[model samples]
Target: MQITKCLHTALLVADLARAEHFYGTVLDLPKAERPLNFLGAWYQVEDYQIHLIVAESVPADLVNSEKLGRNRHLAFSVTDLAAAKDQLLVHGCSIQMSASGRPALFTQDPDGNVIELGETQLA
Candidate 1:
């Protein structure tokens, strides 16, 4: 059987409230619908859903420094990389430009999940 649909991506966090604030405020991901018994938060991003699960301990170094340009990361397109970089800097976040020289920058969440925000291209 071939897998076709991917429903959601689940990420572990130390605190649910902190994760909520980080995602809700920083990334501006809207709170998606979840079952009442669910213990975590669900955020709707485009056609996908991000589920933040509360974990006792989160792993460190999820973002590799050496392979940043070639590493695993969640990428999103922004209108302006310079503006985004400045805004992220305001929040004390580090921005790493793509080693390939593309108009993109990388950062992470409170739990150290690697994220890349790239400038969108207009057709």
Candidate 2:
């Protein structure tokens, strides 16, 4: 069997409410069906879906600070990198550029999960 595509990506979040605000309200992902006992929410973006799972509690080390450059990150391809950066900034996200001269914006959800917004050149 051949691989088709990614169905969803699950992120462990400290606060389910915050994740819902960011991914649902900010990113504007449509609502997806979620299990009542799941303790988190799911958002749909085009074909793929993002599932935010609520963790036990917020880590003491990560409290009061935004997660930056952690080992894990999710990248979303956009049509306009600059526009995406501006939109993210408008939503109170901290945008950072990559060192490779390519346009990129970095932001974290309330749970300190890093979300990357970038674009690929069309052929």
Candidate 3:
């Protein structure tokens, strides 16, 4: 069967409240829904959602969770990269530029999850 869409993406965090503040308040992602049984919160972006899950411990197979790098990243296209970077900085998030230059900036969430914010450069 073919996959039509990505239902959600999950990130494990040590603290749910901090993750909620970062993803919900700092990143400005709208809350879709949260279940009491599930130890996570769903944050909606354009057509998809990022799920931040609180876990007591991280699995050994989680490579990205061990180290924050470029390989594992979530890229978001924005109208203004500079403005987005400024806002993220105000939230105390660290920013980095992509190899392509100033069109994009990379940063991490409260749990050190890499997120890329860039301007949609259409050819």
Q: Every model's Cα RMSD, please?
A: 2.0, 3.6, 3.3
Sort the predicted structures by lDDT, highest score first: 1, 3, 2
Better of 1 and 3 by lDDT: 1
Q: What is the lDDT, from 0 to 100, of the residue 81 in candidate 2? A: 84
Candidates in order, TM-scores: namely 0.84, 0.79, 0.82
The true-versus-predicted C-alpha distance at residue 83 of model 3, in Å, is 0.8
Candidate topping lDDT: 1
Whole-model Cα lDDT per candidate?
Answer: 0.82, 0.75, 0.77
**Model 2 C-alpha lDDT per residue in residues 16-98, reported as the tens digit of each score:** 77778888877767889887686888888888988887889755343323434433678887778878777777888876676
Where does candidate 2 have its weakest 10-residue lDDT segment?
A: 62-71
Q: Find the number of clashing residue pairs for candidate 3.
A: 0
After superposition, which runs of candidate 3 have C-alpha atoms over 4 Å from their true positions?
58-69, 121-123
User: What TM-score quantifies how close candidate 1 is to the native fold?
Assistant: 0.84
Per-residue accuracy of model 3 over 41-114 as CA lDDT, tens digit each: 89898789887878897543326533334457777788878788888889888877776665887787776678
After TM-score superposition, the amount by which residue 29's alpha carbon in candidate 2 deviates from its true location, in angstroms, is 1.4
Stretches of model 2 off by over 4 angstroms after superposition: 58-70, 121-123
